[model samples]
Target: MSLADSVSVTVKHKSHAADVKPPTKTTARPALTRLERAERFWGWIMVLPLLIGLAVFYFIPFVQNIFYSFTDLDQFMNWSTFDINNYLDLFSDDDFYSAVFNTLFYVVVCVPIGLAISLLLAIGLNQNIRGKALFRTLLFLPAVTMPAAVAMVWQWLFNKDFGLINYLLHFFGVSAVGWLSDPDIVRISVSIIIIWSSLALKIIILLAGLQSIPRSIYEAADIDGISTLRRFFCLTLPMMVPTLFFVSVMSFIEVLQIFDVVFLTFDRSMVESDTMTVTYLFYKNAFYLQQKGYASAITVVLFIFTMLITLVQMAIGKRLKVA
Candidate 1:
């Protein structure tokens, strides 16, 4: 066709293309659609039974536990018999003081030592090596094992006669220790068990923390010729502080609430004091002595201890943020 005719046709086509409206931008689905709301409603409905169970089994009993601490629940059904004598008596009781001291000592000694050992394990396991999966699984076994079972096994192992530990000690020409019998050594034995049982979880947590650390940071350290100890202190520890903090708090709580291991390991038939953890004492007072009110007081004290630890952690976290 003629040049003007071709040019006119091309211009017409361009005009038509421009006139055609682009597909209207599809509107986004509304937030919380009817279907979404339905799903959420069902979710809450499914959880209703759990909420009810918690209220009935935990919340109500928790309030009553606190109330019982203030009252003489053992002596009378009436609130009129209520007094602060339970608190007064708890303070006066030598057994209570010893139990508190023993429990606090366990927590103080075990948590830091356990964390240090578990961190070393995590570092070793985190290294590029053969059979690491098997190693990880073996390390985590204790975390899944039943506490009572561990307690029983350790009790047997710690036995002065015919025990694996003592047998090993004898082989090395060391005397068999009165691990369970001696009050001085009882806390150490319990601490050992706590460390063994708690090691698995802390190792897993720290391994994850180690893995989460950016590779670039290590590369930079290498480029700067940073020493191993310097790299660890400057890079690893600081970065892993949050995880370490969490692990420390959890370890403290677990050590503080220890019951099964201490109960299983210690010989209750003994004349000498062996196992007198706060929880053990609480059980002895609550059930064996029929002083539920006094036991409740002990429980309240434990609750306070846990809350204080959490609060201190929060304060430290705030300070970290400011820094």
Candidate 2:
């Protein structure tokens, strides 16, 4: 071959060799170490008990409740054939409607008022005021108190003839009010008790939220000569949205299921129709009236209502940019 031909042939061979690349090797994930494997196994072991308990206690019973709602139960608690009559009867019952109305009234009256008062109390306690720790303890005491005891205390305070509340009213020339008896005023009376008892936990929550806010923000606002009132409206409120949202949601759920106050404060003979909450009504049906299937249906309705309300609150919170 000529020298140029030999050089050209060598270049062609080099180019062809470059084009034919070597096969790539597949990479496998590294095997976990024995320690890591043991850690994972222990983690699962720790969580398994909780999962089992939840399934056994909560999930299974919840499913059974739903099933029972669709089936009639005889006096002996034996399940009968499936039926939708319970729901039909529930819709037509005036007592059911009254209970629903009363429950909604509690929600509407208690939650907002409680939230406002709680926020104000939290702000006051968060200040550099003396005895704040004592105040906090006193405010939070109600949250830890038994619901039945609290109801009993308020029942005495609401006595028409000789209660402290009526005594004070008489001093101001107002007539003695029937706090637990009259249909027109008993709802408000119960609402007052609910709001009072709920304030403690809400105040604690708001106080924590307040403490989480950086002091530097307030210092900057002070440097700008911002008034405390202005700062609260412009700065504090915007920052407290998440905490407020949480408190409102919890309050709504709690108030919707109010039973203790009504059950403890009033009897079947004393304006039961006016004071009956959905939960109270459920208790009456399940235990007192032997209407287990009907009570189950009430619970299902309550569950649906709670879920819908929670969804609406979450949507509103997202719209407001709550964290």
- What tens digits encode model 1's per-residue C-alpha lDDT throughout 117-215? 999999999889999999999999998998778878997899988789999999889998988887678778888988898999899899999999999
Report lDDT (Cα) of residue 38, candidate 2: 100
**TM-score quality measure for candidate 1:** 0.84
CA shift of 147, model 2, Å: 1.8
How many residue pairs in model 1 have overlapping backbones?
A: 0
lDDT of 1: 0.86
Instruction: Give a tens-digit lDDT track for model 2, residues 152-255.
Output: 88878999988999999998999999888888999999899999999999998999999999999999999999999999999999999999999999999999
How big is the RMSD of model 2? Answer: 3.7
lDDT (Cα atoms) of all candidates against the true structure: 0.86, 0.91
RMSD of each: 11.2, 3.7
Model 1 / residue 75 / CA error / Å: 9.8
- Flag clash pairs in model 1: none
> What would the TM-scores of all predictions be?
0.84, 0.90
